[model samples]
Target: MLSPSSDSPADDVIRALADVADLVVVPHTRLADLTTLRIGGRPRALVECRAAEAVTAAVGALDAAGVPVLVLGGGSNLVVAGGDLDLVVVAVRNREIDYRTVEAGGAEAGGAEAGDGDTGPGGIVVRAGAGLTWDELVADTVARGYGGLECLSGIPGSVGATPVQNVGAYGVEVAQVLHRVRWFDRATGTDEWVSPGALGLAYRTSVLKNADRAVVLEVEFRLDAAGRSEPIRYAELAGRLGVTPGERTDPAVVRRTVLELRRGKGMVLDDDDEDTWSAGSFFTNPVVREGDLPTVRSRVADRLGVEQAEQMPAFPAAAGGVKLSAGWLIERAGFSKGHPSSSSPARLSTKHTLALTNRGSATADDVIALAREVRDGVRQAFGVELHPEPVWVGCSI
Candidate 1:
């Protein structure tokens, strides 16, 4: 289903990379087949790079030709457009896990990355290649009595994509333990290790997540070898574990609890559950100015009664802003879970209001249509504008 564009520059670029490495260069790979949302259209070219060198070569060639390239990892954090997409996709599939050099102690007090748990050494660290499944890495870490990543269990994506989005769950973000990332720099045609700060890791955003700024080859994480979890900070998780905030527990226990919680919310992907067929949360919580909080509150009061408005969820955040739950606002706006008609291909997850799902037959347009409907309805009912959480390729809401 490759569309005939004026230029087939991507094919020529991918060919050069294949010549240099063991890569599988294919044509007309559909984006819908790669993403969890099961939407999007076909890409002009798709190159599956199985090694770190292959990833660099492919991305480098595409950059030289000025062909737009989408770095595909787990394909879980993306929402692409329909029809023919004007880009090539370079999928990173190199994977390895080395826990040999870890230390027997806890992570450095503050936020310094811990060493590998290599009992015989100065420091040991757990090393995972970019293509490793995120949850699989979490499981391995927890199994070995390491902590740092327990709260991130069940997140759907690859290890490489985690740092790209500063992936976080249950009050823990990848920034807390990301030691370093080895990436291919398209601008300089050089590969090097860079710190998290260099990537601008903040609020579900990173330089790599922006596009093909760089293709991450591998990532290293520092974990506590003593097997204790990172200090629990989220209230719901802390309550479930029967611990107070800032308390640490066994990493395995935390991982289990987190996976269970994610499953209940349909955050964990399940083929049988149409509701789980989504790009996780569709909208991030809206952070509004403190003064605008009163405006949002009044809007809720005018729509629903004052009692319901008083019950609306709102949390104070830094810099005179308030974080309001997008789910709460959506539900209060009369769009409940499984909203609009269930007969449609796109619908809100029956278990979680924040997720928009594809019921087997949804096209990119169907999901987009539902997203717009919910987003517009919420904006009209409440004065706040909700932003989507996933990265979009050729579509916007």
Candidate 2:
């Protein structure tokens, strides 16, 4: 529990937010309990808002008071420090879902056209509250025979965070289907809906990530009405579904196959599996300049032989560079799955090299140490710098 002075600024802000409708002030809540990593310490206080207006009210008050604030969603992509922190957590808890049908060739929902071949007749738009669980929304869409979101199945976190990180899996990214985002702009104190172009969406990041620019209140995604999944661009997924790449299949089958692949890599969250207790993927695939690719391949060949280096996974990134697999790099750098032995509190996940997991007793420091070791090892071995995917608070590697 926080025991600040009577006149502390946090206390004053709490008093000011007491009357905000649908906002609850929770004291002594640990970040560990709120995050999927199951590690972290307590914030000064937690402000849980149940509605969009309430979220705006609470966050606006904190911003006005100059109180340090952390806008928490599902806590799936956070790496927070331990000990009693000085920041206040504003939790978005609005859980509304609305589906609107758009007539083909009509005005698009959020100023964006539907996917290719989706203009035949009907298109579905799903507006989900920022606080709703991500997978829950995906399951709902698949259950109704809708497509578009099946490739992103089994991802943790909230709907609001999808655009923030441009969440993607199985070759599908949120930027491909995002209709519009309703956000509360911090700088202007105005609530408005903006199209995807307003967001600087990249491989795995956006303007909203790591910046306190705005708080997402709700998100809308376009869906296919023909009950067919998005074109399978991932080779592994397509091979498993017995279809060639770029072919569309059943949404249910895609969802099931994606889930299976995720579970095998311990990407899905499960209480019984310690390996699933992580911040999903710890590192983004490193994109190297086209000219530098040869140097990296030469280094790999010198150390790991020509055959292994030739088989290294390299994909053409949208930004004109070759994206190298971080997991493959980590393994080839001598950091195997469950590296540094079974006795360490924090180590590489037993199921996946890219995930840094907590063995029930790991601290933020433990995770940071292991992350540095792997990142530095890869850098030394291949000259490619690996960047962390999760947002960091009060700590860094």
Against the true structure, what is every candidate's RMSD? 3.7, 2.7
lDDT of 2 by residue, 1-397 (tens): 2443335687888988878899999977899999988888888789999999999999898998898899999999999998878889999999999887777664455554343323334788888999999999999999999999999999999998999999999999999888888999999999988888888999999999999999999998888988989999999999999999999999999999999999999999999999988999999999998888989999999999999889999988876799999999999999999988899999899999999999899999999999999999999999989999999998998
Alpha-carbon TM-score of each model against the true structure: 0.91, 0.96
Least well predicted 10-residue stretch by lDDT in candidate 1: 115-124
* Model 2 RMSD vs true structure: 2.7
For residues 1-397, write the lDDT of model 1, one tens digit per residue: 3463545876667656667665888875788899999888888878888888888878877888988888998889888888987888888888888774443353433343543322232333567888888889999888887878999999998988998888988999898878778888887898987867688887777877667678788887877766779899999999999999999998888999998999999999888988899999899889999888878888999998899889888888757788899999889888898987779889999999999999999887888888898888999999789888999888877
RMSD of 1: 3.7
Candidate 2 wrong stretches, greater than 4 Å:
1-6, 108-121
Q: Which stretches of candidate 1 lie over 4 Å from their true place?
A: 1-7, 100-124
lDDT: which candidate is best?
Answer: 2
Please, what is the whole-model Cα lDDT of each candidate in the order they appear?
0.83, 0.91
